[model samples]
Target: MGGLTQFGQGLILAAGLASSAVNTHAETAPIEAHAVFSPQIVSGSDALRHVAYELVLDNFYDSTGVLQLTGIDIFAAPSTKPLAHIGGSGLAAALPPGVELSADNSLSIKAGGHAVILIWLALPRDIAVPRVLSHRLEFKTQTGAVQTVDGVPVRIDTTPPIIIGPPVRGGLWFADEGPGNAQSHHWGGLIADNGQLTIPQRYAIDLFGLDAKGHAVAAPIDKLAQSRLTDWAGFDSEVLAVADGVVRDFQDGVPTHDPLAPQAPTNDLTPTSLYGNYVILEIAPNIFVHYAHLNTGSVAVKIGDRVKRGEILGHLGDTGQAGAPHLHIHLSNSVNFAGSEGLPFQIDAFNLVGRGTEGEALNAESDMHLSPGKGKPVHDAMPLNGDILEF
Candidate 1:
C-alpha cells in the first residue's frame, strides 16, 4: 500500500458508484473497491491458470468507528456461482501485513482511510475463463449494522501473453520468488512515486543458477561466510537480451555487495539502489524489458543503442537489493522503475529441470538441497515459483 495512498485524493472525488449497497433502506455504501489492473490468465508450473491482481478498498464512512470487513466473494460475470470466497481468518490474511485488525480479527478500515487486498485467484483445469469478474463484499460497522455491496466489475485482458527467449543460458536455473507464489515479494510489490501507484514487479522473476551437482554455489555451505563473489554460481554469468530492442534507460557504477555482509546498508536507500547497474530495452511500443542487478561497469549498451535478441547486455552479479548473485528480469509499460505496471511475458522455449524449495534464497540450505532430475519441455509459458529450467 506504499503508493496506494495517492489514489485517495482523486478517488474520493471520483464521480461514480464505487460500491452499491443492497439494503433497501441505505442509499449507498461507504466502502468503495475496484481492481487496479485488468488481469490476464497466466499459465503457471502447477498446471493451473492464474489471475493475479489487487483490489483497492477505500472506506468513506465519516463515522467514528472503523468498517469491519466480514467476507469477500468473487463471481464470473453473468454467473451465479462464486469463483472464489474468503472470510474470517482467510480474509484477514488477504490484507497486507501491518493492517490493523479489529478485536474479532476482522480487517478494519479506519474512516476515510484505504486498504489494499492482494488476490491470486487460480482457475481450475478445464474451466472456461470468464470475460469479466465481479466482487461482493460483506461488512459490519461498529454499531452492529450489516451491509452488502455488489457489482464491482474487473474486466479480463484477453490478449495473448508476450513470448520471448531466455535471458540466461547453459545452466540449471531456478525461478526464485517468481509468479504463482502467494508469498513472493515480487507478487505483492507496489510502488508509490511522484504521486502515482504502479505494480512494476507483479510479473517479475529472479533467477538463480545451479551447478552440474545441483549446487547454487561453488563453495561448501558452511564456508558461505568466508566465500568470495565468484563462489556464487551465477556471478559474472553473461546476461543476454531477451528480444530485439533499443536501450532506453540504464544505470551503472553502483558498488557490488559484500558476501560477508549481504544486507544493504539502511542509510541513503533510493529507487536506483534497489536495482544497481541495470538496463532497460524498449522491445516494442510502450513495452520495455528490464534486466537488473548486474556487475558494476558491465553494462555493454548505452542509452539509444539498438540490440538484437540474445545479445549480451551485461554480466549478472550481486548488486542493488540482491543478497545473492541472480538476475531479476521483467517486462513493463514504462522505462522508469517503480513508475510503471508489470506486463506478463512468456519464455519461447526451455526444459523444466528441477524445483527449488519455495520462499527461501541466498542461504546455504536453499542452495544445497535442490531436487534434481530431467523434466519436461516447456514452450511459451512462464516458469513459476521454484521451477528449475535449462536454457
Candidate 2:
C-alpha cells in the first residue's frame, strides 16, 4: 500500500495523539475490524474505479492498551497493484480514507479506543473484479504480531453520483466529515423522512469559520455566554452553487436563535425537521445538494431556478435544529435530507491552514486555537475537524 495515494477529508476520529498511540503495548482482548464499502458495486469498465469505505476497528485491550501501527498492507499475494493504499495529511478525519498516519508513516491507537479507518481504493481492472475478487489485509500490530484479515469483500454498486467541488464560498468554513452527522452515529442522526436505509450524512459535514491564525469566532463576544448571531463570522456569509442545477426543494423563514441564549436554539427538533429552513439542489441526475441552517429571508434562488457554479444562493444562519450560525452541507442520493445515502465530495481546491486538536491549548483571549493541518493546498479533499481552509 505504497503508491498513488488518493484521499478526502475523511472523518475525524476521537483517538489519542500520535505520540501516545505510537508507543505500542498489548493488553487482553485482540482487535476487531469491520469494513463497509459504498456504491456497493465496482464496475470494471469505469475509469474511476475508486471505492470508499469505513473500517471500524475496536481495540479490546484491557490494560494500558496502546497499539503502534507499523503499516497497513493490502494485497492478494501476487497481484501487481494493491486494491487500497493509505495516504493523507495527519488529522483525525483527514486520513486519506482509511488509517490516519503521520508524514513519516507512523500511527497508533489507545486501548478500548476505536480507530475508524477511511478507505478510498482505486481498482485497476487488470487485477480485480466484482464478487470473485479475493483480498487480504495484513496489518502490523505493536505487539509484533502480523494480523491477517481475510475474505475482505467489495460490492459492485451499479449506480452512484459523481461529486463536484465545494458548493459555497466566502473566506473559509469547516464542518464534521462522518458518522455523527452522516451515519447518525449520534442519536440525532439523519434518516429519511420516509424511513429508508440511508447514510445521507455519510458525506455530510458541519461548517464554521476561522481567522488568519486559524482561530474560529463568530464575532468577538464579551463572554462565553454572549454568542450573538452576528458574532459568528460565518453568519450571513454567502453560500454558492456547486454546479449548474435546478432548485428542487427548499424551506426558508425559520427563525434563527442566538447561540448564547440561556435557552438558545429555542426549539426541540430532530434531523427530520427538513434541515431547518434549508435548500436542496439537484446538481446531478438523481443527486441533490442540501444546504441547511440558512438565514431567514436570505435565500437568493427560488424553486426551479437554474444556477451556475459559484452563483450566490443565500447566507448562513442558525435556523432549524442549528444551535449556532453555520452552514450544514452534504450530498445525498435523494432530494430530501433524511434517509438518503451520503455522497462524497471535495472542494475544487483550498489552501491548508492547519488542524484543531481535541485538547489543543488555546489563546487566553479565546476558547479556541490555531493548530494542525498547516501545509500545502488540498485538492479534492473535504475540510476535516480543525481544518482552516481558504478556497
Candidate 3:
C-alpha cells in the first residue's frame, strides 16, 4: 500500500508539471512601453533622414517595486539585428529632464511610475525607410532577475513633411537648438500643462543671424553682453509669412526686455508673457504657423487679416522670454504655444553655407566661426541644429 501511495504522488506531480508547461499565457515583464507618437521620417540639412519620437515606459505592477532599465534596442520589424542599441551612458542621456539614472547607470521606474525616452534615430539616405519599428527593453527586476520585453512595435509615419518658404529673408541664419539631440531644451521639451503633457517646440527653430564672418551680433564680441537690442544682428530683420494664410491670433504690447538686466521671471507667465509679441497664421486647414519674440509695435497685421507668402509680418527682437534677439518659429495645429503639438516643416529653398553650435555662436570672447559648407543648394529640406544657411 505504501509503494502504491508513492507511485500515486509521482503521477500527480508529473500531471501538474504538464499543466504548467502547456499554459500559453505568461507575462514577460512587469514593464510596458509604447510610442507617444508615431515617428515620421523627415529630411534634415545632413544626408540622413531623421526619425524623432518618444517612448513611454510604464511600471504597471503593483508589487514589483522598482524596475531598472538597463538597455533599449530598436529594430526594424521582423529583423534580428537592431538598428540602434542604446545602453550605458547613451541610455542615461536619453532620459528627459528630472529623470536621472541610478548609481549603477540604470534608469529606474518605480512601481506605478512612468518614464520617457527620446529616440533620435538617423537613417542613411540610401537605406530604405522601415515601415515599422520594434523595441526590446532589458530591465533588472527588484528580485535581482534580469528580464526582457521584446516586440513592442510602432508604425513609421511616411507622410511627407509640410513644405513652406523661409520665415526670415536673405542672410546667414543659424538654426540654434533645432532638431538633433535629446538634451536641447526645445527637442527635449515635455510640457506638462492642465494635466496633459505635450511637446510644443519639438521641431521649433531659434534662428540667429550670422554676419559674413559668422558673428551673431553687430557689436564687438567683448561688448555683446552689455549691448542693446539694436546691437544684435538679427534685430529688426523682417519676419515673413511662410504661406498664404489669415492671421489666426497674435500678441502685442509686451515690451522687449533689457539685456543687462536679469531675465524675466518665469513663474506665473501666461502665453502672452512667454511668447511676447507674436503672430499665428492659419496656413492650411488645421495647420498654423507661429512666429514669436517680435519687437513691440512691429506687428504689421492684425487678427483676421489675410497675408501672402513672403509678406512682412513683423521684425524679430529680444522680447518676452527671449534671452537675446532671435526669431522663434514653428508649425503647430493650435494657436496656443504650450498646448499645441509641433509639426516638422521644410523650407522651399536655402543655400547651406556653414555649421556651428549655439555655444559657439553665442560665445562673447571671440567671433563664432562656422565650418564652411559646400554651398549645396538644398530644396525642400529642414535646416538642422547648428546649420548656417542663406535663405
lDDT of each model, Cα atoms only? 0.72, 0.53, 0.74
lDDT by residue for model 3 over 174-213, one digit each (tens)?
A: 7776776565667567777777667877788889887766
Across 1-391, the per-residue lDDT of candidate 2 in tens digits comes to 0000112223332222112122133332366765543444322111234444555566676673666443343443444334444332323342433344544455566777866555444455565444423344344555555554454444445453354666566465444333222122321232334544344566556666545554345334345346566655567888888888999887778777666443323222333374566778898887788888788888888889998888888888877665466687877678854456666665556666545431221121444444435446666555544455566
Ranking of predictions according to lDDT: 3, 1, 2
Where does the lowest 10-residue lDDT sum fall in candidate 1? Answer: 4-13
Model 1 regions more than 4 Å off:
1-29, 88-93, 97-105, 218-226, 260-271, 358-373
> What's the lDDT of the predicted structure labeled candidate 1?
0.72
Candidate 1 per-residue C-alpha lDDT over 1-391 given as tens digits, one digit per residue, 9 for 90 to 100: 0110110110000111123334555324587898878898887665567787788888876774687776677778887667777665555545553454576867777898887876777765656988998988877877878766788899999987788889996787867766654345565566777777778888888887777655566665566667788887788999999999999988889888765454545433244657788998999899899888899989999999999999999999877877667899988888876678888888888888766552233344444344345667788788876677888
Best by lDDT: 3
Ten residues in sequence with the least summed lDDT for candidate 2: 1-10
**Alpha-carbon deviation at 85 in model 1, angstroms:** 1.2
Off by over 4 Å in 3: 1-27, 218-224, 264-270, 364-374
Error of 1 at 101 (Å): 5.5
